[model samples]
Target: MTRLRTLLVLLVLWCGVAASALAGPIYRVTVDTAALAGQGGYLDFLFLGLQDAAPATATLSNFTGALEGGGVTAGDASGSGAGRVILGNGSGWNEFAQHVGFGGLFGFDVTFEVGGAAGDSGTNLTLALLDDAFQYVGAAGDIVTFALLPGQADGVTTDGNFATVQAVPEPGSVALLALGLLGMAVLRRRSR
Candidate 1:
């Protein structure tokens, strides 16, 4: 019985250590008009670091506008095979304008749009965070840095880039794990 108790206690300690080890790092980023903007649209990009060697997937939400209010949805650009302007990047800085909102515990939302003469054409660009292996990790509040590329209707201009960071718990639930280890340690000491 005593040997069994000791083994259980050791097992508990190992689990606790493993849980702590799995607590992945948190990264975040945000962009505002100050970074990049134009007469009718803007562009923002975020970059995040990967915690492990495992591959990560990145997801993007709608973009919110700051001034002339309008929500930018994912849509293909003129003659471009790209999926959507708001979500993916291709050529020029794409217009992004909308109120940023956190979708839920796992994701958030941004706004984007385009404005200029009917025939006027330009591009907005934003980069997604890539891991060492060049894999994309979904953009969350925990972003490391971001960039804002201005639209080029006829010229380029420097604008504001507003961003924010939020904390997110590691993927796995490891709370209360310490308490379990403590109980096991006490049991082992008592047995000794």
Candidate 2:
């Protein structure tokens, strides 16, 4: 009877651990506009568009954006397509306007998750930078393509060029995990 009780408790704890780890994949794409500065001195607009092809079980959501230096999302450019421009307007071409001054950083991140029992075998996402007229501006290296396979432990691939794409833990979750680890370490030390 005692052995059966111990097994039941272990099973419950194992299930709790697995349930806590269950979640979709998160990716962070940080664009170094500074490297593309030679292509243009002023980044009038950043094309925050994504072209993706994913497994039927996979879906994308929770898109977030940030900017360094100066710029704003042009409402007109908020959609999925090759011509979408999510950054500054035509006025940004001039030195006086609010724009990412070539040397600034533009960040775009997305979450990919498996919505069905089939699971996400793989997914591809493409990101780009565009001009005021919604024309492609960056060079080959500046443009990045990410291939994510949720099935794998570390399932993110890229050309590894000028652009930066990485998997990051959610800030709140990471903080909580750090606190838990510290508490465990303190308890272990006290027991010793």
Candidate 3:
């Protein structure tokens, strides 16, 4: 091949490498039930406004909680393609439900990778909690809502409030994965 053509191909391949290197950080958000146990309220419904986040990119299904009750249902609302905004809004929210309330003792972790940095504030994760149909919880007798704000949902220490656990991929691991893919590509080409 001509030198110019080879250089162009190398440039294109380098671009792909850079793009693949820019993998987003994975996070696991748990709707903690430590404090909610025996609170006469069931955290059955969990919703998220992923406006700036990326839910569709999630490869794994929602993590089922260890609760004995109604059951669990999880899916990516962004797939509905109802509108431009995937984040929870008037368009809709990526909603997951345990059907049976955790009753404050059982909690599930939903791991996801944001399109932004591993822990960027721009990837704010707002959360909402709902009870069984028509069931009133708390003194307000209204649906309960909680955001995984800083210090609000610290899964590390379990503050008894909603907690978020960020699962950032190890750099060495990601590099290994990228290298594996590259090697596979080279092998396929050589065989051809």
Q: In lDDT terms, which candidate is top?
A: 2
- Ten contiguous residues with the weakest lDDT in model 1: 48-57
In candidate 1, how many clashes are counted? Answer: 39
lDDT of 2 by residue, 39-112 (tens): 43333322222223232221223323332233343432333211222321222121111234355565545554
Tens digits of per-residue lDDT for model 3, 67-174: 444434343433211111122322233443334344443333333343433443322233344455635343232133333322223223322345444566645456
Instruction: TM-score winner between 1 and 3, please give it.
Output: 3
- RMSD per candidate (Å) reads 15.5, 9.4, 9.2
Q: lDDT per prediction?
A: 0.35, 0.44, 0.42
Clashing pairs in 2: none
lDDT of 1 at 46: 29
Model 1 quality (TM-score) = 0.32
The TM-score that candidate 3 achieves is: 0.41
